[model samples]
Target: MSTRRTLLAGSTAALGLAAGAAHAAPSVTAPQPAAAPGGRPPNLVVVLADDLGYGELGAYGQKLIATPRLDGFPAEGLQFTDAYSTAAVCAPSRGSLLTGLHAGHATVRANPSSGARVP
Candidate 1:
């Protein structure tokens, strides 16, 4: 097989392995906190930068590009270093983001592999 085909096959296999492991693992649910004094919920901003690797930021290990915006946002808000996207591609990654659901629970993961404009 060609190198491109080999790489694609490897990536597919890796995704399958991750899915299986996630399914086999026991589920743990955190306790819900009581509502605050006011009825309004906290404001949230979820930012997903496409094609960004973990080491692409100054907070990680990048020493080349300057990422002052990213470096400051987490400090002003919340910083979740352990968060992960369900897929390694844009379309599916976005599906999870807008719906507040995992890629495994969404139909988009199985179709159009990646890169579709959000409706």
Candidate 2:
């Protein structure tokens, strides 16, 4: 009688495991949105300033520079308050801009001499 009871208990546990495996829940996934029709990327423009502090612009709270022309730019364009250049000097920074790389990865690390002419 005890042997029969053990067999029945084992069979019931096996059946429960099989049922759980058979009735496993399907995975839910978020639906992907449709792509844009044109397949073209958005336009972008980058502006760099030399020897200019952030507060020197009227948009940045400068009152004495008389920056009327540049004041309206922030309203029409995207302005970044926390943006920084790759380099403190102009040459490496310009090199990074032209090459689409940071100063550490730029090929030209320093400004060329004034006597050195580009052919």
Residue 40 deviation, candidate 1, in Å? 9.2
| Sequence-dependent TM-score of model 1 | 0.51
The C-alpha lDDT values of all candidates are 0.67, 0.67
Candidate 2: worst 10 consecutive residues by lDDT?
26-35
Query: What tens-digit string does per-residue lDDT give for candidate 1 at 1-119?
Result: 45433645665676676667666646633323346669654454557788888888886778999998888866676565776667878777877666656688776774363556545
lDDT (Cα, tens digit) per residue for candidate 2, span 1-119: 54423645665666676567656655533323345567653454456677788899889988877887677778788566886677877778777666567577767776667758432
TM-score of each: 0.51, 0.52
Candidate 2 displacement at residue 12 in angstroms: 66
